[model samples]
Target: MAELLDDLRAETASFEALLRPLGDDDWERPTPAEGWAIRDQVSHLAWFDDAAGRAVTDPDGHRAALAGSGRGDGPGDVAAGGPAGSWVDALVLEARGRTPADLLAWFRTARARSIEVFTTLGARDRVPWYGPDMSGASFVTARLMETWAHGQDVADALGVTRPPTARLRHVASIGFRARPYSFAVRGLPAPAEPVRAELTMPDGAMWTAGPGDAESVVRGPVLDFCLAVTQRIHLSDTALEMAGSPAREWMEIAQAFAGPPGRGRAPVSG
Candidate 1:
C-alpha cells in the first residue's frame, strides 16, 4: 500500500512542478484535448482528486457533491455509450475564473488531501469511484495513470517531451487490464480472444501480459503502448508492432480511462 501510495505522491508532485512555473497565458494554451486549455487539464485533475478523497473518507458526501455539481463524469453521464464531454467542460468552467496561481494552489491543496486520505486505506480496502469501485492499490495506480495521461496533454501543448520513467509500468498495466472495459465503453463487444502485450520498459526490461501464445500480440516500447491506449497518439504513429485481428482492432480503439470513448487524436500528418 505504501509503495503504491508513494508512487502516486511522486507522480502528483512531478505534475505540480510542471505547473508551478506557468503564468496565466501558459494556462490558457490549448492542449490536445478538444476545447480544453492547460488550465482545464489541471482543473479536471483537481476536481477528480478532490472527489476521490471524498469518496474514500465520505462516500455519501462524495455522491452528494457530484449530484449537486452535475456529476462530472458520473454514471449517468453516458452519451452514445461513452461518458459525456459536458462533464469535463463543466469542471473547466468551474475553475475558469481563477488566475494561474490560484488554480495551481487549488490543485496542490486538493491533491495533497487526496494523497493523505489514501494513506488510511488497508491493502484490501476498496475505494469508490465515478464508475466502479477499485481496490486501494488500483485506486492509487488509476490516479497515477490519470496524472500521466493528462500530463502528456500538457507536455504536448508545451512542445515538451518528458523522459520515460519507471512509473510508466503503472500506466501500461492499466492499459492492458482495461482491454475489456475498453471494448465495453465503446459499445462494442470485447473480443473473447486475448491479446498479448510484450513491451520493453524504459530501462530495457521486458514487461509482458497474457499468455505467450495468445496469437494476438502488441509489442513495442511500453511508453508508446500507454500513449496509444490513452489516445495521445494514433497507434500507427507509434513504433508498436501489432499482429492478429484482435490486437489490431483493440489497439485502434483502446481507452485506458473509464469515462468516455475518447476522441483519439488523428494520425500525424506529414
Candidate 2:
C-alpha cells in the first residue's frame, strides 16, 4: 500500500506539471475524449477524487450526496449497455461554470485530502468506490490510472508527447487484469484460455503476466499496451504483437476503464 501511494503521488505530480502551464485557451481546447475539453477532464478527476475521500470518511453521506445529485444512476448502477457518457456528463455539468484555476484548485485539494485519508487507513481497510469496494492499494492505483489516461488526453490536445515512465506499470497492470471485465461488459464470454502479457518497460525491463506457456500472448512496449487498453490509441496504430485469437480479440476491444464499451480511437491513415 505504501508503494502504491508513492506511485500515485508521483503520477499526480506528473499530471499537475502538465496542467500548470496551460493558458485559458489551452484549458478549453478539445481533447481526444469526445465532447470533453481539458477543463472537463480535470473537473471529472476532481469530482471522483472528492467522492473517493468521502467514501472513506463518510460512506453514508457519500451515498446520499450521489443519490441527491440528480445523476440518475451511480457508476455501480449502470447496465452493461448503458450510456456511460451521460453519467460522466452530468458530473461534469456540476462544475461547468468554474474557470480553469478553480478547477485546478478543486482538483489539488481533493487529491490531497484523498491521499491523506488513504494514508491513515489500515492496510486491510476497504474503501467504497464507484463500482465496488477496493483495498487501499487498488484504490490508489485506480486513481493513478485515471489520472494518467486523462493526462494523455490533455497531452494530445496540446500536441505534447509525455514520455512514458515506470509509473505506467500500474496502468498496464490494471489493463491486463481488466481483460475479463472488458469482455464481460460487452456481453461476451471471457475466453477460458489465459492470455500472457509480455511488455517492455520504459527502462527496457520486461514486465510479464500470466503463464509463460499460455497460448495467447501480447508482447509490446508497455506504453503501447497501456494506451491500447485505455482506448487512447487504436490497436491498429500500436506495434503490439498478438499471437493468439484471444489475445487479438482482447486487443481489439480492450477497455481498462469501468464502463460500457468505449469508442476507441480510429487508426490514423497516411
Candidate 3:
C-alpha cells in the first residue's frame, strides 16, 4: 500500500521536474495531442487529481461530479466535470487567463491534496472513476499511467528524450488489461484470438503477458508498448513487432484510458 503511493509520488515528481524549468512560451507550445498545449496537459492532470481526491474523501460528491459531466444543461457543466476530450477544450479556453506559474501552482496543490487523501485507502478499498470502481492499487496505478502518458506529450513537445524507467511496467499492465476495452469502445467484438506480449524493459528484464504459445504476439520494448496504448505514438512509428491480424489490429487501436476512442497519432512514416 505504501509503495503504491510512493511510486505515484515519484512518477509525479519526474513529470513536475520537466514543467518546473519551462517558461511561459514553452507552456504555449502545442504537443502531439492535436490542440493541447503543454499547459493544457498539466491543467488536465491537476483537474483530475483534484476530482480523485474528492472520490477518496467524499464519494457522494465525486458521484455528483461524474453525473454532472453528462449533463448538457449548459456549456459550464463540462468545464465543471466533463471527460478529457471536452475537458481539453475547457482547459484550453481557461488557459487564456492562466500563466505558467499559476498553472504549476494549481497542479502542485491539487496533487498534494489528492495524495493526502489517497494515502488513507486500503488494499480492499474501491475508488469510483469514469468507469466502475477500481481497487486502491489499480486506482493509483492508473494515475501513474496518466502522468507518464501526458508526460510523454510534454517531452515530445520540448524535443526531449526521457529515459524509460521500471515504471513503464505499470503502464504496460494497464495496456494489457485494456485490450478488451480498446476493442469494445470501438463497437468491435472482442477477438477470440489470444494475444501475448514479450516486452524488454530498459534494464533488460522481460515483462510478459498472455500465453507464450499464443499465435498473436506483440514484441517490443515496454516503453513502446506503453506509448502505443496511450496513443502518444503511432504503432507504425514504433519498432514494435506484431504477429497475426489480431495483434496488429489491437496495437493500431490500443487505448488504455477510459473515454471515447482517442484520435491516436497518424503514421510518421509512409
- lDDT for 204 (candidate 3): 99
Count of clashing pairs, candidate 3: 0
lDDT string for model 2 (1-270, tens) is: 788888889989988999999888889898876677889889988988888888889977766765676542345211112254577777777888998899999999999999998887775678765555667667778789888988888888889999999998999988898899888888999789999999999999999999999999999999999998888888888889999998999899887777557777868854
Q: Could you estimate the TM-score for every candidate?
A: 0.92, 0.91, 0.91
Clashes of each: 0, 0, 0
Top-down lDDT ranking: 2, 3, 1
Among all candidates shown, the one with the greatest TM-score: 1
lDDT of 1 by residue, 1-270 (tens): 888888888888788777877877999998877677899888888878887888999877776776677554543212112334565566678889988888888889999998999899886787767677788888888889888888888888898889898899989988899899888876898689979999999999999999888999999999999998878888878999999999999998888887757667778955
C-alpha-based local distance difference test score of model 1: 0.82
Residue 240 shift from truth in candidate 3, angstroms: 0.9
| Candidate 2 collision pairs | none
Better of 1 and 2 by lDDT: 2
